[model samples]
Target: MMDGSMFIDEWHPSDHYMSEDLTRPARHRTRTQSPPRYYYIDFGISRKYDASNTNPLELPIYGGDKEVPEFKEDYSKPWNPFPTDVWYLGRAIQETFLDRYTGVEFLSGLVSDMMHSDPAQRPNMDEVFSQFQVLRQGFSSCKLRSRVAHDEKRSVFHFLLHWARRIQYIVRRIPPTHTSLA
Candidate 1:
């Protein structure tokens, strides 16, 4: 099942006890330890549907991210929560990552589609995931591992240092992104 309240803050790593092995410091963890898992919270405004039900609709319940375009204009009207969920996730990524870092411009297209003004025009979560997988597969390891430099200005020394670290990571054969680990 998908979350109805899909704001970024609603997702969190499970409590320490629930994921003790994965939560432990790297030095303390064993090679066989499972990857960390995240859980969704604050389901007070969430909804559930049967597998047969495809086009479920609901009146808006404002979430932590209140910038949903449809809701901003007229939230009283019932609409598909699925597309709004897509907007929540897309806006979250745009604000949390795209706006704050570099080297992830590949996501701009997908994010733009997810945040389309017309909710009906937005791709559903499944499509989003599928599109993201395609994007992820297209990136070379080095490109994926390239330092996601902050959007802020930095000194030449810092820029050189970043390249140096990139070379070091390549030499050490470190994996670019952690999603593959999961």
Candidate 2:
């Protein structure tokens, strides 16, 4: 999580560019060490299915990006939600990074494939990850390393500040009489 509050997948403008205030020393500036790694969270609704079960449970689409065409009422048939997840991820990446940044043509095709309207056309997670590995190889070493370094530094600062605040809160809560315990 960037800044301990925003998820990288959520795609806020701040995630792409650091504001001056955030870059200041007080905010615990991020170091430019390695490429930033993203983590997926919020798995409260996640489920596991056995591979033998050809017909996985298909409940009516409830939460998530409302723009998914398959979620329409007219599409009464239950469909695998996995492809929907791919679409959402693609859309998030496109809208958040590709749309705002330039010189990432390598990712455009992959993103397009992921966002294909037909779920059958979309590549599976393994294929997507493989493609990403290939594409990442094309990035300039300096650029990739610098980006990672910056994010790492920022993360360190955020971690330290969070702990500091917690400690401060606990210290304040201690009774004054307990300050000089024998």
Candidate 3:
């Protein structure tokens, strides 16, 4: 099942901060270091079904995010959790990333499909991954290396300050997106 608990502060490793800011430093300001790794947890509701069973149904067990469309219509009916998992992932990305940042417009199509109200209309994991690959390949390395700006407009002072840091990052060849050492 797609539990919203998949991502939380506890699941991510702490970063080695070089500044006093309580939040994560901006990409340009971040020091060159191994990127933090993140993983999922809370498998209290997870299941492992036989490979032969393509459609396994289970009763709803509400997760961290209670906004799933399927569960809203009928709470007691048995439903396949696979498509719901796709919805969870799509909604998570939509809320956590797309809504808050710019430069990821390429993901809109796939996210829309995954979050379809009709579960059967959603693409399977393999299709999702394939589409993601195509999207990823479409971006040039320079585009990928460019800074991801926030959706909100910054004040004039902040904008100039951000550009100053951006120039420094460009000169130093610091990547706009952090990478894992492994």
Candidate 4:
């Protein structure tokens, strides 16, 4: 399921939050056999280029969070936004999952490759997917899955705690006169 406010030209404050959501456990669906794949949505500022064109134009438009280093005004030439997307995804993975979790060294390495400062050095989506396939095979039926499961359980506990506090706050706001049944 999609979440977050959709912003076209305006800067979305929840960009990073939505990015983190990608790493969370997917909603279970009985009809679906494969795992959920996250996709970039709300491309309000997205531009279309000719199929024959390989080079991305240096547009003045700066979209999403300003975390992308290449988008800095000082950069001499315009670089491809495709690589910028790769960097953002890498950063999201690092900030949302790897830095907070344990036993995902291989995944961290892959993210590092994507977040490399040099846009040219970053792997395309195909290469990234292939690498993920290889790395995932190695981690399959191992400690990584257990670690993720533990993290999920911890997240659920924390979520419940947060909501409990909110509920307590709402309950405290009610007047004492309302306690008696009519």
Q: Over 4 Å off in model 2, which ranges?
A: 3-31, 34-36, 51-57, 73-75, 140-182
Order of all candidates by TM-score, from best down to worst? 1, 3, 2, 4
Off by over 4 Å in 1: 1-40, 179-182
Candidate 2 lDDT by residue in tens digits, 1-182? 44423222333255444443455222222322112345777878776778776446486456766777677655667878778778888888888767765445567899999998788899876788888877766655433422222223457675677456445544666221112211
Expressed as tens digits, the lDDT of each residue in 132-176 for candidate 1 is: 888888888867756676767466877897787667766777555
Residue 165 deviation, candidate 2, in Å?
Answer: 31
- For each candidate, the alpha-carbon lDDT, in order, equals 0.72, 0.60, 0.72, 0.60
The Cα error of candidate 4 at residue 39, in Å, is: 3.1
At residue 83, give the lDDT of candidate 2. 81
Model 3 scores a TM of: 0.68
TM-score per candidate, chains pooled: 0.70, 0.58, 0.68, 0.57
lDDT of 4 at 26: 33
lDDT of 4 by residue, 57-95 (tens): 665457656867676656556677778778888988887
How many residue pairs collide in each prediction? 0, 11, 0, 0
Candidate 4 global lDDT: 0.60
